[model samples]
Target: MPRIALIGGNARPITTAHELGVDVVLVHEEGRYEPDFADYCSRILHAPIGDSAAILEVLRPLHAEQPFDAVLSATEYAAIAAGEVADALGVPGTTARTARALKDKAETRRLLDEHDLSPIRHAMVASEQETADFAESVGGRIVVKPADGVASLHVHVVESREDAATAFKQLREAGYTRAIAEEYLEGPVVSVDTFSHRGRHVVFGMSEYQMNDRFVEWEVSTPSRVAAPHRAELTELVGRLLDVVGLTDGPAHSEFVLTPTGPKVLESHDRFAGSGAPELVRRACGVDLYRMFLAVQLGFEELPQTSPVNDHGAAIRFFTPQPGTLKEITGLDTVDALVLTVPPGEAKGNIVPLLSRTREAEVVVVITRHPGDTLPELRSVKDCSSGYVIATGKDADEATAICERVVDQICFHVE
Candidate 1:
């Protein structure tokens, strides 16, 4: 079996790696390993995935002894470091320079500006004053987010200089030293998932999302509803991104907004789109992106074209509820479309939890309240979730309808 070096401790990739019959030597931080991951891995090297020096120190000796066939990572925290390691080991993967630029939003914007890949105007700000100035310059309406944000955390739309300054302070307090403020663009956002090999990008799939009141992605429908002409346009744009970012291999989840002017990239991640997206891809197209990532790293000279597996639409919906302590949760096991569900007890319980910038609380005083373990209040996407529900149907509308039935049945009695 070919030995592979996988950076990070995400269990999904580990389980898939095992299925591929590859010996996985996981390089991860201390205490980052999932309990079940050990069963699939051949060896575990505990070190911070971000520490290139430490990772190299461990992998250098191992490579000299047995030699790893490939080095790769599926997690954002480990992608850059994984690339650096691959470069040091003389393996094929994304270059360390490319990985670094793609990981930081500010850096990505700068490169896009330099390359004329996007028309979106943006600036990086480290202080409230800088944020206020940028917002003013952008007609007093802008989107502010952490320079290195992931999973859409701390992404906010500020309509005024005051809001921008406030957002800036909140981000700084949250440990984000630098942030990006860009002219707010109004449009529908679609994701283009692709696989790149030797500077060639192949479109894998596209997904569109439905955001909750708080702007958290509550539902994602795959095989996006984008028309054929626009789909081709988006594909070409993603190809340009791949070239500019220097991602020669592996998967990319590139998001773009369909602005009236044209389609422009919001941001792109050099990894598989999370939230059960790989499963959606498998159902829509006969492509296993997880397997592809591994195969490429393991030195597959050419990847075969995948035919459509089924003519259907797939959707994943996350549970969002009103904030309060949980009195009881029902219909946990009843949903047929349920793909992942974490118990209420296992999830967090909170009353009047701090909402994200986009979400607002509707005050209603209740006469009676049920007493039970506290349920986590819904705030951002990172907040404790009841888990996700996945459904497949003949079309996007049908898939969403199935998801609605599951969502309606799952109830949380919050006080």
Candidate 2:
């Protein structure tokens, strides 16, 4: 068996790694921690994020003592560091420059600007004054976020100068040296998953991502049901971006906006899509993205072709309770797939649970092949019921309706 070193071995990709029959080395302990199964080769290396020196200290001895074939990264930060390690260890990985550019929001914006691919006006701010000035210059609403982070942490849209200043102060205090403030593009957010090998790029699939009113991501559905003609244009834009960024290989997750003007690149990751997105893509289109990523890391030239397996649609909905103890959960029967964050009893407030902390809620995913899948129209609410429902369909309208219904059935309790 080929020995492979996996960084950031969390539950999301562990199952796929097990199925691939490769050695697994977990880099982070944020999720469930455990030893490898007796049948599979696995180990836990105690190295946390932001401590690249320690990771090297531990892996250096192992590289000298054992013969590992390749090193793969399962997280954004880890992947950025792995690129540097791969250079030193003579292994295949993303270039450190590319990784850094992808990981840092400010750097990404600069690159896009240089390539003339940036569709919206953007600025990097280090202080409240700078944020206000940029917001004024842009003239429209602005979206602000940490220069480098994931999961939309500290992401907020500022409708006024006051909001911009407050957001900047909070982010600066949180140790984010700078934040990117860009024009808030109006339209649906879409996630495009793709893989590249030796300059050959393939778009695994595209999904329309839905978010709650508060800007928390809800779910993702394939063959984006927003508009039909936007698919090809989005794919071409992604390909052009890959070429511009000089991203030659590995798995990539790119998020963009299907605005009235055109597709605007929100950001891109040189790693596999997170949030069980890889699995969702696999179900919608018969592509094992995780497996393909491993192949690229190992210098494979081609990936297996895949087609949609089922005509029916699939979706995953996330759930969060009101600002109180998570007493219980109900109404799961309306969905097909589910994952929970808070157990039956736990204190929950504001749904701003830290990613490094415990899982605060669960996800209920749904899939159906029913023809003309029509869901009851839903009225958007303010609190209690907060989350996203990911759905796919044969056409955009069918998928949109299912998503609306899934959103409606979700209800929450807090006291």
Candidate 3:
């Protein structure tokens, strides 16, 4: 069996690697991996996934004894480090130089601006004064986020210098020493879930989102109707991004805004789109991207000759309850969805995706709350979710409708 090293992702890919009869080693942060992941991994190692030196320390010895065929990462935060490991091991995957550049949003923005690919006004700010200066230069609202932020953490929209300083301070406290400040692009943002294999790029489709004031995506639907008109534009831009970024394999999602001028790229990722994007891809297009990630690395699958088309639709609607003590929750009889158990604030068990299937439609409900746990407010993508409902239908509208109807039935009573 071909041995593969998967760095810093959920258990889905580990399980996929195991089922494919590959000897998989999982490298993750201490106390961060799911318990059930050990069952799938041939060897489970612990290291800060962001620290390339530490990860190489653990993997280098093992690799000398038995070589690893490739290194893979589906998580956004660890993609660069995973690439570094692959390069250090002389493995086939994302290169170290490419991953480092992609991880830095400011660097990618500079590349885009230099190439005149998708120009969005941006600057790299290291201090509050720099942030404020950039914000003032825009003369309008600007978005300030961690230079390597993931899961929408510490993203601040500031219109004033004071606001920019405050945002910078918050990021500083969060241990992010530097940040990217950008002129706020005013348009409906959509995700282009594109994949590449050996320099070839293809977009599976686009997805739309419903975001809160805090930028928490409450609802997500694939094959966006609003973005369909600019398919040619998005496809062309992604092709350019792949070329400029040197993304070699796996999934890389680039977000673009349908601005008044046209489509301008907001940002990009060298990994699979999160928020159950692989599930959405599987439902809409007959492609399991997560499985594809593992299979291609393990040499069990080949890159497709043509891109998969999105025929149907799939949607996920999160349950965002009030931030208070939970009193009670009602309305379980309406939807026959799976109930996943977890502690109120945090979960330490297997993040199993719960699904109830039938021929016509399928419903997957992942509930992270119970009767006594306090619910947190919508913040970053990490701790905000109380639960979520995922469904698939004939079209994007129908899939979104199924999610909304199911979400309406579940009620959370918070004190």
lDDT of 3: 0.80
Query: Which segments of model 1 are wrong by more than 4 Å?
Result: 30-33, 227-229, 305-310, 337-374
Candidate 3 segments whose C-alpha is farther than 4 A from its true place: 343-346, 349-361
- Name every residue pair that clashes in candidate 3: none
For model 2, how does the per-residue alpha-carbon lDDT over 27-99 read when each residue is reduced to its tens digit? 5544334333223446666677546676677677778877568767767858677777666777666777788
RMSD of each: 6.9, 7.3, 2.5
**Would you estimate the TM-scores of all the predictions?**
0.87, 0.80, 0.93
* Tens-place lDDT digits, model 3, residues 1-415: 8888888878777777777888888899867765677888889899998888889999999899999998888877688888888988898878877887788888888788788888878888899889888877888899999888877889999888788778988999999888888899899989988778778887886999999887877888998999989988888888898799778787898888899999988888888787777788789988877777877655578878776877889988888888898888788656776545454444542223332121234776677777778777678776555777888889899999988888888898999
Clashes of each: 6, 14, 0
Candidate 1 at 243: error in angstroms?
0.3
Residue ranges of candidate 2 with Cα displaced over 4 Å: 30-39, 299-301, 304-310, 331-413
* Candidate 1's TM-score: 0.87
The candidate, 1 or 3, that scores higher on TM-score is 3
Ranking by TM-score: 3, 1, 2
The lDDT values for all models are: 0.72, 0.63, 0.80
